[model samples]
Target chain A: MRLLHAVWTDMRFQWKHGFYLVYVLVTIIYLIILSFLPNDILSVGLPLVVFSDPSVLGLFFVGGIIMLEKMQGVLSVLVVSPLRTIEYILSKVVSLAFVSVLAAFAITGFSSYGSVSWLLLFLSTVLTSGIFTLCGIMITAGCNTVNQYIIKTVPYMLLFVLPCFSLTGFPYSDLFTVIPSVAALRLMLGAYMGIPLYEAISLVIYLTGMNYLFMRWAIRVFENKIIYQN
Target chain B: MLQIIHLKNDLRQILRDPIMAILMVVPLLLIIAFKLMVLYLVPFIQALIEFDILPYLYYVFVFVVIMCASMLGIVTGFMMIDDRDGKISELMSVTPLGRNGYLINRLLFSSVLSVFYSILGYYVLNVVELPFVTILFVSLLSSNYSIIIGLLIFTFADDKVKGLAFAKAINSLTLFAFTDLLALKWLTVLSWFFPPYWITLVVQTPHTLLVYGLALLVNFGWLFLLIRHYRKK
Candidate 1:
């Protein structure tokens, strides 16, 4: 519950940020455009955006958040807090994951066919966002400067984003079952969905476990590494 | 001659810079990955070759090509901006390495490196069935266009952060439209104005030498203009 408070606090801080709002607005305009697209166009647009969009926004904000905190000397304070490294990271995870899922859900509510399972759609987006946000934390936490972060993140970001475009390009909707982000999107489409409850639960657990491992790694790196010289 | 001196100096600095070391590795990584990914494409290509979905493949290739080029642009663009505010450019201004040499070296160095980076993307996939002439043409097109574009941004990017922002914005705007079919046809309509729009057409050809030559001329012409302005500035 305290972690929930911390998450809300961080989210409030993000919402009040002028640039954050501007970015959200830019994203909103893009979403609005997608809403108006024809079905054929939407088929590709939905999957591509779903696949790539998280990291686009996620990595930027994660880098900004970490960099800003370091610049302001808040990172040092966090290091000394009663919050364990896991807890400190949880604050970031809870906050960013909640916000990202909410945004995806809001967009889904308005733009997508929504004939799919709303609960499943929400669950899957959160699942992908959880892992992706953790990745953002890892990269942003490691790099001292924005330039290094951009360089390190850009190639992986491209790798992560481009292949999922193949999902829509290819016919086997089951492909999503193998790919994390695409699986989440499959749950989003709310159709052609096949998977036993046991299978779904196991997949979700595997993904969530990966996020936990990455978060711990990021926090450990944060705790031990002196991130900057100046 | 002063420019060659700064070129040497900048080259030394770039060699020492972590970012430069990184730029050297990126092409290699993409080449490896693209090669693996290309294995999958063989089957897809066989199916799609008969369809107008060539446009879609064209879109994907163009996206990948621009991604390669823009990565180069972002690197060269930021480093140039950083050098400008640092004592380096100001020092060159006073040295026998006159501003002309500095600008010329920037042009030559930037274009050459950008081309190298773009080829790495194809190397990973070993997507080299096209003629060597065609590959060179495409590399020049991708790299030179980015180099020219970077030169234009270098003129206005007053700081490192702004330079990075320009890099991201250019990459995003280009990649975004191709991936998102929502604005799909709208973007195709718009891509007519951009250089990457032609890359797909150039690469898909079995005897695309003439097409590549045309692209090289168009890109080199732009490069020439940007280089000229870079001098006057």
Candidate 2:
């Protein structure tokens, strides 16, 4: 299908630009650095670190990809093509989600040492990547350049990413669960330990719902700002 | 007079740039946030860690300031790369500004912003009680590291994506100042090679003229080498 071809092209383009290499290098380095920490701190910190890396990393990488395509006028061509807008958008989300899942696995596999559930890890990463990549696409929709994209997204980035730092410590608050990242972090932490079936199911439901809403919003924004504007 | 005109134009361009404006504002807001954290969250953090973290607050303040300086450097580097990509630098080469003139203008712009952020960081954090002259001296010396970062970023990064990767890598390397607090003997020994480490050292031991001089020499040496490499490229 055209969607698969587009996704493959995007993946190849990103790989050619060294995005994959930089990502792997960052993962390896982060794991190595975490290994240096004392065991007590490392155990408590691993979930938060994993949450920050693949989950939040999509925000920057996907934003960069969209901005690059916008700058090169590739999106304008896509807008005029017979390819459906949803397919084009899905290609981006799927490609970035693939990369994010790989990064999450690399980090968890190397750092957690079989302590966390692989099933939970995969679920959290897919949901987190899908949510954040759509967020990136939405944020970059109205911007034509990287600088503009950064300016518009800084406040959102701070809001989305900074609150998860609080989850690293104890005195767990019900208030933190309202943030999607905190929800993802809770799932990750639960995977490290164990989670009640209901809790795991609820969090997955919440993330899936949020992902659907964000995907809808991103598609709308892309149609209005990117497609129609061109 | 020509330099003044160039400076004015450069400042206007920065102001017009949304990304530069965001970068300028974010650091100030972070400084304010740090102040609030020290005022409110310190007690909570102390309770959590079950130790007095107050003594190490000065280093934390310096780390934040150095981070701001490095960010400015990366932004400046991106601006230069943008110029190159758009052929603006090539066009300016034939203008009255010339290439060297343009380079100095960009360096001055970034360095001055670095100094401003450093001073703002020091005054806002207010953790260390140093003489005003010492603060200014250290800030001026620290700003050179930002210039060095800018040049290195420009030399290595061909586009925005590569520029971002280099910026992250360089920042990770330069943030060794924080490692000095880990109290690891080998890390301290290794920290001596990094200019930000020297800046933190100067902050910790301001009375030591030797440490201050070494920071100056290292920062200048790196700046010289980076600029030379960039020019050759």
> Which candidate gets the maximum TM-score versus the true structure?
2
Tens-digit lDDT track of model 1 for A1-230: 66766777777866555324444554565576677777766765664465456424555556656665776677777666665656656777666666665655555556764354555555666667766766677776667555577787876666665555655655765565555555555444442144467756666676667666767777666666634332
- Winning candidate number (lDDT): 2
Clashing pairs in 2: none
For model 2 chain B, give the 10-residue run with minimal summed lDDT. Answer: B173-182
User: Looking at model 1 chain B, which ten-residue stretch has the lowest summed lDDT?
Assistant: B172-181
**Per-residue lDDT of B60-129 in model 2, one digit per residue for the tens?**
5787768777877877787788788778888888889888888888878878878888898888889878
Query: What is candidate 2's TM-score against the reference?
Result: 0.88
TM-score of each: 0.63, 0.88
Write the residue-wise lDDT of candidate 2 on A1-230 in tens digits.
99999999978876776667877877866775777777777766776677777766667767667766777788888878888888888888888778877887888788845477778878888888888788888888776555666677678867877777776565866577778877887887887777898999999999988888888898999888877864
Error (Å) of candidate 1 at residue B158 is 7.7
Best by DockQ: 2
